[model samples]
Target: MRYRSSDEDSARWDGFPFREGDIIISTRSKSGTTWMQMICALLVFRSPDLPASLSELSPWVDWLIVPRDEVLARLEAQPHRRFIKTHTPLDGIPLDPRATYVVVARHPLDMAVSLFHHVDNLNRERMAELLGGPAPAAPSAPPRSIHDSLVTWINREVAPAEAMDSLPGVMWHLTDAWQRRHEPNVVLIHYADLVDDLNGEMRSLAAKLGIDVPEEQWPLLVDAAGFAQMRARAAQLAPDPVGILKDRNAFFHRGGSGAGRELLTDEEFTQYEKRAAQLAPNDLLAWLHR
Candidate 1:
């Protein structure tokens, strides 16, 4: 497959050194990327208090702001099983046969709602300092209300799934992963499933990643990944020590589905459904939106 890089430097997956048994956590943004990262950290370290922050332990390789060589060196030095994070879909990546790829998803409406707040948290000035350039212009202020935010988010269309950050782009990201979910190397996870049964899901993920935790240690790993514990450790789990977020706690806001459901009108909900149908098959749509 032809690989492409995003302006944000997310496409730097090319030429990445992949060792056997490496785990690649690929998911659309706000679709439980940090959740899965924490899970991997817990499973690998088998402790609630990691030696380093989650982001430091499992860095997003394609994030250009961090410096590609620095990220590579950190991963290479790590002796534990490496699990990397990426926002790109399968097609945009190298698709190594020797490594395991775990793709996570969430209900689209809920994801949008979470992302709306996520955008608000971003500190463009800090990001620009990291990039060593003039800070990008600040984003327009958020809508006066969440209802207005959802309406604007759903109606946005910069390109037809051209950028992975757009509404259409998010659909295409899920569509690519859904298509290859049956492959031996690719495993699919849902945010709703985690919220429903985190312990069960963590065990299942352990099996998928070929990690065998001692039965006694299971509780520690599961407990550490729970919402409350993670939220308490937000400074460590949050990737924005650079002050990208206005509030660290807001990053973990309402980690369940249905926030968007309550905010949408019947007609707006129908429009979202129609758009989903256009982007994916019925089974995938049902699985995603559920």
Candidate 2:
């Protein structure tokens, strides 16, 4: 499966080195990838202030922007428990029983809305500058407003797992994880669950990743993973050291869900539901939007 969006090549995972107890945080784009990174950072470092920038610490294994060898060298030197990130679905990458996989999911509607802001804010020219390559041509005009953007995104549908950031793509990622949710090594988490109970989710994740923070330092770790804290440290947390966005904070935009739900009209929402039904299992969809 070729995930064309953002030019990410999932093939890079072919030769990934997975040590025992390695943690893989697999998620659809904008579905709390950075949030999970922060949680893992606190858990691994056992400190409120991270040793290095979160992005530098947890590089997307499949992202093509950085050379594969460079990414490998950085991870190879890390002494702490390695926590790798991938936007690809479970089937897209190697599945090692010795490694624990954490798949984070968000409401498809909300994810699309978040992705809209994310794609629109991308500074590709800056990215090219950093890569020492000619800037790509400008993108076509985008939808003028959030409402229009939602309408456009919700109506677009690709095959399940076809693109890690599309409507069906989100469902496929969730479905794959849902199927293996009961497995000891694969844990599924919802964005809503994390938002509703940050500390609770963090503890659950810590247990899954076999990370134990001293009882006295639990609060510090929890507080550091909070949305506001991550936003406050956006520059350090955001992966774009090359000024990939016009505003770094924009990458950490609204953390809430249902933005697309509110923007979608009755008829359009009906279409969305129909499409979602065709893609995801009934129970999985129930847990997702709830």
Return the top candidate by TM-score: 2
Identify the runs in model 1 with alpha carbons over 4 angstroms from their true place.
Answer: 1-7, 138-144
Clashing pairs in model 2, backbone N/Cα/C closer than 3 A: none
Candidate 2: segments with Cα more than 4 A from true spot? 1-6, 128-134, 138-142, 160-162
> How well does candidate 1 score on lDDT at residue 213?
92
RMSD of each: 2.1, 1.9
Q: Mind giving the per-residue lDDT tens digits that candidate 1 earns over 1-290?
A: 43233324545777988999899998888999999999999998887879888888888876767788888999999998898988877887888988999999988888888887897787767777777788676459744687887777677775634567667877888888889989999999999999999999999989988889999999888988998988998999987635667788889987888998899989999888877787778888888876
Candidate 2 residue lDDT tens string, 25-125: 99998999999988888898999778888878888888878888988889999998888888888888888988989999998888888988898898878
| Candidate 2, run of 10 with poorest lDDT | 1-10
Candidate 2 Cα lDDT to native: 0.84
